[model samples]
Target: MNFNFLDKLSPEYRNYKIERIKNGASKKLFFKISKGSDSFVCTDFNSDKLEYKNHLVVHRILSNIDISIPTLIEKNDDKLIIVSEDFGNLRYDKILKQQSIKDLLQYATDTLCIINKEINFNPTYTLPQYNIELFKNEIAELPQYYFSYNNIIDRIDSLNDEFFDIWIESFKQLNFNFKHFVHKDFNMNNLIFLPSREGHLKCGVIDYQNSFWGESSWDLFSLLEDSRIFFTDQYNAYFMNYFYSHSNQLISLKEFKLKYHLLNCSRQTRLLGRWVKLANELNQPWYLDFISTTKLRLQSSLAILQNNKLTKFYDKYIL
Candidate 1:
């Protein structure tokens, strides 16, 4: 809350007026700094957090590969503030209400295709793989936050173990090997619509510091099957088929659908728990609004997979 360090960036900004941007569930802070009609975004974060560093590195990587992203204008390492181009308020979630689903999805699908095709790891810096252990840790959020907060389950320790085992076995069935770069949070909320740009460049990606090496279907499902938004089965199938046709990933549609549903099940489960934690611990109760939608999506994924143990687990506890 103390922004005294802004003076280090410019003496003129010492008494400047700014607008706080609602950054969603992230701990980081975003503000729009305006000087007359011109404006820039300032991302304020804890200097000690690893995500702050990752943001800079990933920005360089994505920008180099022609992934549409905000242009970095300045960085003050001491204050942990990054100044970048402001894309205004055209976030995909907001724009979707005004635009056709086909056009919007085409732009988003094309961007995801580019991200999968171009991103790769180098020896100098390594990204974490979306391995089984990582998946377990992510899904742990459900038991720790949601169940405990709601007092829905007794003897959560044992039940939590059973739940994890189900997911572990389910993951094994898919036989996914970490292959493509995953923007772990690839939902519409994190994408911006840049109208002036054409093709895939029209979609500006952000908040991807948590990028990882994961199955190709991970990001695709994250976008199409987003828990926060509801797309009809028709829309989901059309866009997914569009991505498969264009991305040229080696996996067939049959295999991709299997992996997509499995990974999305994990993601939705994590959000179900995480939204509760955000409300309780962070005092951000707005997140609770998404819980019902997230739960519905989780059920949909479970229905598609037809995993008896997983379905039973949900029925006994979560339902």
Candidate 2:
């Protein structure tokens, strides 16, 4: 929120007017600086400089693979500030609201599939693998924030263990590991459509600093279950079918469907806790708005997985 840090960077930007871009959860600071119509986005990370370095590595990989992403302009390492190309205010969700949702989402879906098929994890570059403990901790927050206070921590922990157990079994059954590179936050909100570009290059990506080698289903789960976008049953089914058909088919169709539902439950579980944390810790009601939608998504996913016990547990607190 301070511009004094810019004084040491360049005399040209010292007189620039700063405007905050309130797009995401507000964990980090994003600003749009315009000095006589030439604008760029500056992200002030509340995290360490290593995250900035990760961004640089992943950004370059995505760029080399022909994925459309904002260009990095400059980096102020001492301040941990990253300046990158501004893709303007356009997001895939805003464009979807204009006309048919199915047509619009298909573009992003196909583009994402292309990215996954082409971008393999490079052993030489050393991208971190999103492992089990990290994933379990992500899911563990659900009870820690929402149900831990009512003497049900044990019950919640039991259910958490069940969730992990289910995924471990699925991992064995499908014979798949988390080797695919995933844009951890891949969704309509993080994508911008560039009509000037052709093919997969048409989709411009941002906010990919959290990317890691993770489950093949993780990013797709995030895409379809995005709380910010309304994916109708028809749109959802169409996209799911397209994904399965176009996928590398490393896993069977039936098993891939199972993985999809499991991943959905996993993500919605994390989001339920995230919403509670946002409201209780940060006093942000905006996240709480997704409660009902997230509940519905969890129920639908649980129905597919046929886990009535965990479904009942989730309903006990959330429904």
Output the number of the lDDT-best candidate.
1
Query: Tens-digit lDDT track for model 1 on 1-319?
Result: 5365465456656666677788766788788888777788888877346787888877877887866888898887777888888887888888676877677777878888887777764536557776778888899999888887667767877887888888888888877868678888888888888899998788888888888888877777787777777755557778778777877567778888778888888899899898898888878788888888888888887898888999998888886
Stretches of model 2 off by over 4 angstroms after superposition: 23-26, 148-174, 315-318
TM-score of candidate 2 relative to the true fold: 0.87
What is the Cα-based lDDT of residue 123 in candidate 2?
73
C-alpha lDDT of candidate 2 relative to the true structure: 0.73
Tens-digit lDDT string for candidate 2 (152-171):
65566676676567555554
Model 1 lowest lDDT segment of ten: 1-10
TM-score: which candidate is best? 1
